[model samples]
Target: MTQGPIRLDIAVGYATPRKGLPSAVSFRRWATAALAGRIREADLAIRLVGSKEGRALNRHYRGKDYATNVLSFPADLPEGLPPGVRMPLLGDLVICAPVVAREAREQGKSLNAHYAHLTVHGALHLLGWDHEDSREADAMEQLEREILAGLGLDDPYALPGD
Candidate 1:
């Protein structure tokens, strides 16, 4: 069944310099693509941070020392809401600009494309998609590939010779 357009109220915040970074519109587009057909409405925040803040958040949240790429924080809605009440608050996404740039350069991919992939990946995470195990990882990766392809981007997980 075809679903209607997703109603997204995405707030983009830049904790780092805006220069050489993807604009808020691009992020919103990527997020909407990820949410379309899966959700009807959403309210989420996407924060772009520098390496320092990214590293700190990663360390504090995931116990990782360095900043990875994108971090997804799903919303924790309050309990005791009336039945049939759906919360449109989808949590926040933190993207480390430096890490993304570095990875793009290292992987020989365009910066904008990398950002799109990360944004989509993070959005899926917000929707309760996880890759804690191999099976889950494969499914998530395939979904990501499909979403990116729909966005006219190359497969992010493709090998060098593929």
Candidate 2:
């Protein structure tokens, strides 16, 4: 099915002078690219945050105390909307800049590439894709690989020891 245009919003809340943070244009590009052929329309927000805020959100929401790379919060609209109602709001993404940067450096991946992968990954999650099990993980990872490749990025799952 043909997809429609995308509407993305981005916010940066980190105080640290981090390097390699993607621009709003790049975020839009990555998100729109990931949503291509998947959703006809999307209204999503991407928020770049520090480890403190990221950790707080993780702890409150997922019961995890550490800051993660990316967290997805899908829209919780009613299952059945009234007639003529269009819920284009997909969800929000909270990306910890420091964590992403550190992971990219440690994993030997480019910062932009890692950000692209995470953006795509979070977008997928907003669209109801998940990796809760081996089968689901394989499928999600395959899709992520395809999406990242389309953006001229390498497979994010490749380990350095491979």
Candidate 3:
């Protein structure tokens, strides 16, 4: 892990009503936790969106016609940056507020905790983490659990009655 405080530049936007969503500060905190041991510094954006916008983005990008919880779009930097240079531009995250709310309710989880988990998950994705296979999924989930635990949250992948 890199030493020193992580320099983070985060922009949070709301395309949906912000009445029940997490604050920008909270999102930044979650992202910071996710990147704590993984990255030294980064720039990213988190956009809270309604179902319609979320669905359209999912459809257009992933070809899925539903609004998923969170979508990560990593930064596509230029091909040739000189040596010894680092890009702080990590990527962007799109969170479906409604979907997240519904999932929290269905999973019997605290709303804030769920948001924190998703924010961490999205940030990990921005750092090139993925769950395309069973092994990768397990590793990523373990990391997420550790991050969330650091934030005083329960294991997000635990079963309801476990």
Candidate 4:
């Protein structure tokens, strides 16, 4: 079955020069690709933030002190909506550019590939995918590998010793 179009908005909140930031078109493409065969429609925001904002968000929401890669905030729609009601608002994805770049360098992965993986990962989380346990992590990683492979990207989970 064909899915409805996705509406994605990208926001840059960092003050530093975003040297390797992905274009809005690329963000939309990656998100749409991730959402394929999963949802009919999506309305989400991708916010690029600096380490400060990232850390603040993570601490406030997740109780972590340091900045992480990506944070997914799913929308909480009211329950008991009438049948046939469409909830297009999926939620927001807050990505830390510095953290992502650092991870890419440390992991020996390309910047673009790392961004793609995080984008897909964040989108999956918004779509109700999680890795709170080993089984869930395996399923999520497999799906991530499949989606990234379709985009000609290497498996994000591949370790150096593998």
Candidate 5:
């Protein structure tokens, strides 16, 4: 399915001249477009921060001590047919750049590929996809696999292949 362009509201907490990823806005836009589903006009905030802040948010929200790849917080909107024209406002997708980079290296993948996967994964969450159970986990993984494959990335589940 072809997706239209989107406007991203990005906030970088730890910007540097010589460190971190480049062209993040473009990266996010591509990922969003790659996973376009029910989300219309999204209010996305991709915060690129250090490990400390990442860990704090993870522990407070997800009960995880260390930083994770991505976190999605979807806004609770009324679930009914709406009158007039109101685009759905998908909530935030926060990604810890350092953690993503580390995971990419450890997983033997490129930073771009990892970013794409996390971005797609977080977007899926914003569209209400969770992995708490076997059925949900399988469905989410299938979607992730399809999205990553569309971006020409390898399967995130399969072991690092030749």
Candidate 6:
């Protein structure tokens, strides 16, 4: 029962505002749709931390000193697939809410839209997707655009001044 189609267990730590997060109902629908119902099981730990903690994680994991919008730590699940073997222990996502809010304000996007975008981005990473190359980035962005559109938001990539 640890994994299943869009199984999301949301855990919040630090000072992220609970009231501001997408409702459980909304999150479930969004994640399920974005994952395309392929998730056998999934879990999410969404942390809202200050810039200092964010900076530390970014430095330790990515070798970057500044706080980032999001960081994903995927679980070490078993490799390979033999029919019904599902992906478990998907991973963790850390988001600096302050940073997200600032970015949204700077980009003139709704806060919820930005949150949706980042959540989808992190979830995709858990599903074994990356954007290290232009092609990969394009693919990922296309998926993101579609996902966000389904959620009734404009293209995050096309936001003015982005």
Which candidate's TM-score is highest? 3
User: At residue 46, what lDDT does model 5 achieve?
Assistant: 61
Provide the overall lDDT of each model, using Cα atoms, as 2-decimal numbers: 0.92, 0.84, 0.91, 0.84, 0.70, 0.75
Collision pairs in model 4: none
- Candidate 3, overall lDDT? 0.91
Against the correct fold, how does model 5 do in TM-score? 0.77
Ordered from best to worst lDDT, the candidate numbers read: 1, 3, 4, 2, 6, 5
Q: Compared to the true structure, candidate 2 yields what TM-score?
A: 0.85
Q: Which stretches of candidate 2 lie over 4 Å from their true place?
A: 1-19, 77-86
**1-162: candidate 5 lDDT, tens digit per residue:** 335664544443333221657466656664565456544355555666667877888999889999877878665545633466344545666678788888989989878877777777887787778999999999999988987887677888777885
User: Which digits, one per residue and each the tens of the lDDT, describe model 2 over residues 64-90?
Assistant: 999999999887545654577456767
Between the candidate structures 1 and 6, which one is better when assessed by lDDT?
1
The candidate with the higher TM-score, 1 or 5, is 1
Pairs that clash in candidate 3: none
For each candidate in turn, give its C-alpha RMSD to the true structure in angstroms: 3.0, 3.3, 3.0, 3.8, 4.6, 5.2
List where candidate 3 sits over 4 angstroms from the true fold. Answer: 77-86
Best by lDDT: 1
- lDDT tens readout by residue for model 6, 6-98: 455656565555666656555556556666665756666666677888899999989999999888887754554446645555667788877
Which regions in candidate 4 have their CA more than 4 angstroms from the true location? 1-16, 77-86
Worst 10 residues of 2 by lDDT: 6-15
Off by over 4 Å in 5: 1-18, 77-87
Estimate the TM-score for candidate 3.
0.92
lDDT of 5 at 23: 66
Error of 1 at 43 (Å): 0.3
